[model samples]
Target: MLGGAGVLLGVAAAPAQAAEVSYATECIPPAAAGLDPVQGTTKVEVTAPATAKVGDEVEVVWKFVQAASKNPDLIDLPANSVQPSGTLKAAGAQSGDIAMQGPRENPAIAKGGAMVLSDMKGKLKLTTPGEVTLTPDAYAINVMSTDTKCSPKETVKSAATINVTAGDGGSPPASPDPTEGTSPPPTSGEPSPSESESGSAGGGGGSDTGGSGGGGGQTDFTGKEVAIPYACKTPIGDKNATSPVQINAKKDGGSYDLTVQFKGSVMDSPADIPADSVKPSMEVVLGGADKGKVHVEGPTNSEAIKSGDPMEIPDLTGTYKPGADGKSTLSPGVLTVKALGTTTTCTPTKSAVSLTLDTAAQEGGAAGGSAGGAGVSGSGAGGSGGGLADTGADDGGMLKALGLVAGTAVLLGGAVFTFMPRRHASRKAP
Candidate 1:
């Protein structure tokens, strides 16, 4: 599934040199699972062109060996359900991080069986004519819906280096065809950048519900992975977080079916979070040929979380329909999470487009798609209904009760505290 998600940049002209590097890595399963961290060695072989012209886009591949640890869960995992995502930290001539993702090609593994990760590739565009060093950074292996974040326990050696030279003002030479070694593109309607950017623009500005825009082509991004950054208000303070969102869209009769999945994230809580106290909602913003927002809400957690333990938010799902025609870009907007009596709102700090699709205009006043259905609520433009599900409890009363309980516990000296902080050290998920 991941193999088809690769972007087709131009190929290089010459054969690239690959370097093999192995290092020790430590991984921690999702905090909600309450599993101990494990240490293992990771071996990766990196391939990149030894030399490239400035401003040329070069492909870099990181092939991995068998994982250090096996499947830790009890159930057997099916093939191609595990996806790997990581960062290639670049230094020297180049100064930014390159996001690398691999196809979900893992073989079926029984519980506690050895795990294998797929090779990851990223495209790096050479800007300055100098040498650049690339080293593997922290990565995450998402099995099913759970994630195990891994990082090198020590300083990692460089995986590969590239020397860049000034290029002539002419067109770049073509390298080997990507199809020679990579998997073929999927037959599904995964739109290319060119196709997604095409189409005439027409749509309304602000409405919580209803269709806006003119008719155009359709773009299906069922399993695509999108990373969005959020600034969230936590019980402790304001903290920044990133969520890996998976989007699915299909054209139904007169309306489009859209499903947004939040892969889950590790959060901190200053107080105990009761079961079913937290609900999350997402606002998907539309741009390009159409303009508006679609709101999707998720369910609450089933288990109680003690204070100081990592708070894991369950995945959210919702559907929306588009009425307008033409290409519209969907980007993550505001994320609101309601826990206990307190509400934590997270807003996108940057403009990150998740997917773009063309929709056909609905004729005969077909009631445009509404966000409310399929275990989640959806609202179109100007909808006042909050994206989050109502707990039906009084927020002020709940907060006041919690405060009294905390005060009584302090007076009775019956308070208990447990804290197990996350241990990636200086490494952060890229």
Candidate 2:
């Protein structure tokens, strides 16, 4: 698995810090109590308004508590991490740094066994009117073996929702009666007078589409850009092998072009197994305007697993806008593979990679110059922002042990039942 400290190194060096940083948090609801995969009762709760306006700045607070068994051992809280997921977005604080605290002590042990509690606050504002639902699905905590650090078992806890109302200027005013000496209104489908005026403003000096009828065209958020750090914890079939991460992003049209490449190989013991049987896969989870899972399969086709040849997944092309906090985060998702008719799940070593926006650079561009690279496509191999790629995780040996036991059972059964059948021959007591 990727370590949190290791992942931060991949991020670009920050410029001199400014006095104040405008921050915003993604909208999300809390999680209900449930069982953590490792060993404990996991409870998550997020408190926020049930409804908000389009431009209303809302505060979202969350708390996570994990109660595990009380062993005399002291565990690092960094290893037990949790992250917010779903439609919520974050802008200011470093997402990788946002997590539960407490160095090596179990705060909830006295109340129960071993308990960890984390409380954090974030802000958000909805851009569009809709039913926004945010859930806490990222839970990376694993049960370690006496001799080895096994892969983390990830699971989702609970979720919450918010209904964002339309903006103040969303609807048009009612038409006055022609009988009152006023001119007749335009057709029902046509843009109103106010909308027509705003459309002209958007087209004259901005890139806003004329058809956008409300709020005098969207404010250009293109100049916002940041180098987000990332790490690869699990590489396909190998839990111990290194998994490198590379991200190349450019502003294109209204969105950002992101191409994430994971480089690693599958290296499990008993190498004589058929290469075609090894199918390893990993995914990247991105937040912002574009939020979802981008799944990448290991080495296209059913190619054999070779140490020299690393797995290069496909590119992710989409638009990305700043979230409420004005920042974005790229994180490691789940990793899975199938070998010898058994599937094994693995988690990344690190929790997340954070990207903070360069406000000075953004202001310079916003002054007059337009952000470059509209509709630009990802140039494979070498391109701008292509230089970022590096790596390194572990998994339980449960599947392998089970498979071995099954094979041994089959062999023993054949010797006892199939071969010894003649002892109780069909001729009865003979």
User: Which candidate tops lDDT?
Assistant: 1
lDDT of 2 by residue, 261-306 (tens): 4332122221112234444444545443223444444432244432
- The residue ranges of model 1 lying beyond 4 angstroms of the native Cα positions read 1-12, 169-430
RMSD of each: 21.2, 30.8
lDDT of 2 at 405: 14
In candidate 2, residue 42 scores what lDDT? 33
Model 1 root-mean-square deviation: 21.2
Q: What's the count of clashing pairs in each model shown?
A: 17, 16
Error of 1 at 176 (Å): 27
Over 323-419, each residue of candidate 1 has an lDDT whose tens digit, in order, gives: 4666666666777766434455667665455456655444432123343223355321211111222222222112111211121111111000111
Best by TM-score: 1
